[model samples]
Target: MGSLTRLIVFLSIFAAITLKSNSEYLLPITKHEPTNQFYTTFNIGSSTKSPVNLLLDLGTNLTWLNCRKLKSLSSLRLVTCQSSTCKSIPGNGCEGKSCLYKQQNPLGQNPVVTGRVVQDRASISTTDGGKFLSQVSVPRFTFSCAGEKTLEGLPPPVAGVLALSPGSSSFTKQVTSAFNVIPKFSLCLPSSGTGRFYIAGIHYFIPPFNDSSSSIPMTLTPIRGTDSGDYLILVQSIYVGGTPLKLNPDLLNGGAKLSTVVHYVLQTDIYNALAQSFTLKAKAMGISKVPSVAPFKHCFDARTVEKNLTGPNVPVIEIGLPGRIGELKWGFYGANTVVKVKETVMCLAFIDGGKKPENLMVIGTHQLQDHMLEFDFSGTVLAFSESLLLHNTSCSTWTSQK
Candidate 1:
């Protein structure tokens, strides 16, 4: 063989090998968000009632309570846990349980830390969209660590793990249900790597999805943690949007998909929700039944998804924490919802208020490669008025003495 020919062949082989390796590291999952959403955290039992100033997961399902820790609660204050507004006393940690806790996690499992309304800090994302809008929450809550139970060493200092039947644990039910809908997964919350908060968009705002949406049925599977026992969601797929991604069975062999959806489940609550941005497509999907513990026994669909969302261009600005990391810079958005792109419903996200996430947004999982992301801490079901039974709230001043 000629030298030049041989050299060309050798280089071609080398390039092929390199590209293959890179592909494994960053496989492309569709960019659109397919399902509703998920959270991360579990339960917070009777542990130290002291206020913890750590980050929290908005979708947490921790069991909550109003304790005697806050001695200064005024009668006029209608509280379920502790504080009224989170922005005012973002780091006070005095609130034990309040209405905010109940409003978010409908399951009533979230240990009521002092919940409060966040002061709005509007930031512009799109100027032409008219009024650029976006802001961070103020007066976040502080959980009490005193009088809390300590089981697994891995439990968030404030959110202690809770154990019991699925009916008893909020996370257990949600995680299991989510697992049944999708394939199982090993959640990756690499803080040391990403150095940012978790990303959850669709899960928080309950971004409007398919009109016929229904919860995936699943059961809780118990596992041991560094501290004590925790639950994991045994689902069918771990998808970016609609495609089912394989799970690290080794990591979750015995673990559960802690009640919260994967996004908001975090050690602390950052400025973002618990979801990623992407465009999903389902083609030639199938379904099989698995054990009761296994979420679903089938693969329902294999289709593609690439669509956007619009409502008379209401032009409402939505706020979100970072979604995915690219080039080492964190990104934020005012409104990160769905956008129709070439007949597909993809997750539309904004880029630091630069690119409108709603502009027929479409993303691919390969874009999320080599990045660190986390979700919420616990799976606290918020008690919305419409869904009151799942959750109940009364912000009005009540006389529930500690």
Candidate 2:
């Protein structure tokens, strides 16, 4: 079958599976009280009730918990060299017959510190009608306990990391193995309101796509390489309204043989290029008196417009893909790309990655708001759809498809 046919068939087959209780298992994903990192809170340990707050990281494997206080807990046991789980973890020091993990900085800083691995009971609460209700607990949840120090890039109140990326140690894989659900999940980040994270299957906001007209279809692009934790996809072209930006496709790839990742942090050069192109187009489209905002390179005066104006009338940004799949278009008010920074100004939300890698071009959470992003690791493709926030009341009644 063709790719489209194959996707429909796969979704149909997976959707048919009767969940033990409910077709979908839910989790309460919070911003960790409004920080850059999104988090999912869970309780760890067996009778001791050690609460662990883990950062929901799509860029790393190995769910980790800070064990500084609970290092002596009876539930926390070091994985021996003879165990299969120990072999799945990367790193050395196995001669001691204990699983050791060393934190490596992406910027090539020296190894920060190493931690001992352990498996303990972890439980997360579920939501009903948008309110957190009860808990679904899991025993023998594989994670590492911070040994010498707390996990890097996280501070107190934030205890450990929740791995959502592919691999044996990731939470997604472990959850899938334990539950036998489809090895996939969906996330819908809203521009203004609280967003949601679905562990496995659809959020019930998007109606099951039966035909083309009822729902929009997006192209599924494969992520490149094995070791990288990024969700990389192929970008065919980018257009502002009807005008295509004059960007060298190779520049998006950072002159490396590696694939392009839809990054949360937009690299400096790429952002500069996009901002320049957008400014040129906006100026030509009668935004002659553009205002410069601090941070965001592109901004518009909000004085002359309505006080509660949704946003600027920026032209639609279209992202194209290879084959007959389909294009993703960001409308003036739909995609939530335009933001009101101050009472008198509205600016674009694309942030600068500064010195970050050019190949790390990502679809940040800001851009992902008001959209449903589905990752099918079993199929090795990323599927995206416009969220029902613009139409439906809530995702409560939408079909929870695989």
Candidate 3:
């Protein structure tokens, strides 16, 4: 009886340790309204916890921070030029003995910034699949230390950029290596208030989303690899209110890239087609059009548009992608389709990226808000929940829960 009791206790202790080690990490995402950018904050220090707010960039390779604001530098360690860590980092250089890393500012304000590849203790909250469990310390967290000048165009409080791209020195890669967990991260961008960023493990949400029988379905599409490490996915066709727009096949040959930096940018021709189709549909619904906004061509009088719990009652935009069985369509409802730039004005949230742009279409952060996007690097797939608002919940709903 004594031996059996000891075995049970030992198993229990082992299970606890395993659970803690494999637990997912959570970061709260805050939307900077003026810039339409999203950022996540975490602590980086050994003796003390100093909060660092970083812009979430899906295309950036290396995570670079303004070390000038870092309070505790006692635990900081610089990578040597000869070390394997330095060799693993792309665009690495040697500045004396310390390894140098060159990172681009996602905002395009500072094209290139050189920094030292460094490691330090960073802390983040871990969850027990659904709720917050405890805070865990990640030792030797890899990141680069950039100068103050590199923070141009970033939010006043933001000190750095968190790279979520598929790079050797990306935040996702380092976290996966440190925790020995799956190489996946889920981003829930909120239209307002706060959202949640889950790293590794299963993604859990509240009532409707968590319910197995009645939960909203997710569309899984392939994530095409790019030389620049940007997340690109093939968008076969686009429809505005169930009517497909006539687009040149060549226009979509390059595929559409997901960006957290700018607003949705479509090739001039594609934009015109989408705008015209949407305008016709809006007119049919008795929606009045207003003068075009700077970036958005389709602005409408907010008073004329009806409002629902989801958002402004506007035409749904569907992005069609290749699915295993057939074509999968990710629908964007009013909440994700239109943005209120003013009290009386709302606009179709898309920008015209002139002719010959790098990627034919770039889906931006404004359209991504209130949607759940899971980037699974191991599977090379992107599983997306079209719009959380459709399920009578927003990304903010997830963060508000305990």
TM-score for each candidate, following the candidate numbering: 0.21, 0.75, 0.93
Q: What does the lDDT read for residue 70 in candidate 2?
A: 56
For model 2, residues 115-155, the per-residue Cα lDDT tens digits are 67788877665443233446666677877765434554453
Model 1 scores a C-alpha lDDT of 0.24
Error of 2 at 203 (Å): 5.2
Note the residue pairs that clash in candidate 2: 204-398, 262-362, 262-363, 263-361, 263-362, 263-363
Model 3 alpha-carbon drift over 4 Å, by segment: 1-22, 210-216, 398-402
Tell me how far the alpha carbon of residue 276 in candidate 3 is from the true structure, in angstroms, after superposition.
0.7
How would you encode candidate 1's per-residue C-alpha lDDT over 332-386 as one tens digit per residue?
2112222323222223322221222211111112121122222222332111111
Q: Which residue runs of candidate 2 sit more than 4 Å off their true CA positions?
A: 1-23, 32-34, 68-72, 92-95, 104-113, 125-134, 147-156, 202-225, 253-264, 284-294, 304-312, 323-335, 352-360, 392-402
Top candidate on lDDT is: 3
Candidate 3 TM-score, C-alpha based: 0.93
Clash tally, candidates in order: 155, 6, 0
Cα RMSD for predicted model 2: 8.0
